[model samples]
Target: MDSNKAKNLEQILESSIKDPKDLTRYLYYRKKLKEEGLSDFISILPLGAAINWARANSVWPLTFGIACCAIEMMAVGASKFDLDRFGSGVFRATPRQTDLMIVAGTVTYKLAPRIKKLYEQMPSPKYVIAMGACASSGGPYTQLGYQVIKGVDKIIPVDVYIPGCPPRPEALIDAVLLLQDKISKTIPQQEAI
Candidate 1:
């Protein structure tokens, strides 16, 4: 089946339904196909479905804020920047639950290992955005603060770094848009990197 046929998210939602509020017709089709030992044909659904689903639902983020920049991160999710417009407004609390980790504030030495652990917990295809100067190069803290790490990137490979003491919400939105653009260009490999 052509992916163009699945462009209507509503139709995809309709076909994917299951049970009481569910897909009686779909289940019937599945059962008939199964009993006939034609499950090989059914395998294509997951492939097509996964591609469709990822385009729509990819980039769940871990919002780890340690300082002023966190507010900018919050503003991106609010009415103005509206991070939801790109499906990344959901601020995931746990690293295990998100793939896009936006380090919006200062990352101190004490927090470096925690950040590393969280990065490890995030599933494959993960990305890290070092937001604000505090998170990027430790901002003004780099001059005076001995405790602050020079940047989150000192400990993690940063995908995008928004440079500002606390970057504006618009900057965060731009960073996310860049991330989206990158995601769109990505192709799957035979094996995970």
Candidate 2:
């Protein structure tokens, strides 16, 4: 239905619910529907919902991995784990062609500048996922003097941090899912006339 009608219906339902538990449940589901991009309030959107939905589904990650986590990232792309099912299996070799960066390994101070440069090359609305303890916080290499960068986030803004010595492939998949949810919530800038 239309936005106004939907809002009115929602108000009526919320007002009519005498039980606090039922009202809470209704609000929770309503928020969940909006996050899932299934809400009927699309009329109020600046046509951004459709674009956000597409971005959420078709995330192309940059094919740059630094450590052992790269192996797990590769496994996620393989047929068994099947990351392609989520439309994020095609990892691009260049930052210009990708919207997602999965820092899947340790980040050394020497490599931090390159990571920052790559992140800068990415298009607007790009996302970064730190996919291992190393990438997230230097992992076991944190004490290696001025070698390990401590965290990839020190160079680029990370959207999700999956912690593990080298997080499992399943963890990478979950991080992608989490990133999709974050992308879906973004309100795009309305186009000027």
Candidate 3:
């Protein structure tokens, strides 16, 4: 369907829903469909939907782990956890070649500059996932250490923050999936590297 038709249909649906939760759910799905470049009539047909699906499933995260959390990040890629199932097991060594950056450890003041540099190297519409307590908030060293950054976000814009001293492999997988969901909803501004 055309954009105008889709908008009319959305208005009808929004007006018909009285319950707040149901309306919210409806709006969320509608937004998801729109992000994928689909309308109610075109959703069944695969055009724009296929492109978004491919983008969502084929996220290549840069291999840039720093501290103890790096070990957990590795575990997620191991056969036992199998991050490949999420289509994000391939960790590119080059920042220029990847879309997702998983900062899986502590970021000290000294390392913040390098992190920011790497983030800037990533192509447009890139994403960062802060994947540990230390990376997210400096963990136990938040107050005591002057060298450690309170959070990686101080250096780069973090899209998802996973809270754990060193989060379990399962948590990393969940974070990747969540990042995938976010990617699916976004309209890429540039071609994938």
Best by lDDT: 2
- Candidate 2's C-alpha runs over 4 A off are 1-46, 191-193
lDDT of 1 by residue, 52-150 (tens): 447535677887877888887888888977888788877878887887999888888888899898888898778889999888887888889988999
lDDT of 2 by residue, 1-193 (tens): 6999868745744664567986787678777878989777543222355578788999999998887999989999999999999999898898899999998887877888888899999988789999899888888878865688888877788899999877778888999999998887666655611
Best by TM-score: 2
How many backbone clashes can be found in candidate 2?
A: 0
After superposition, candidate 1 runs with Cα above 4 Å error: 1-57
TM-score result, candidate 2: 0.75
Which ten contiguous residues of candidate 2 have the minimum total lDDT?
A: 41-50
lDDT of model 1 at position 150: 92
Instruction: Please provide TM-scores, in order, for all candidate models, with all chains considered together.
Output: 0.69, 0.75, 0.74
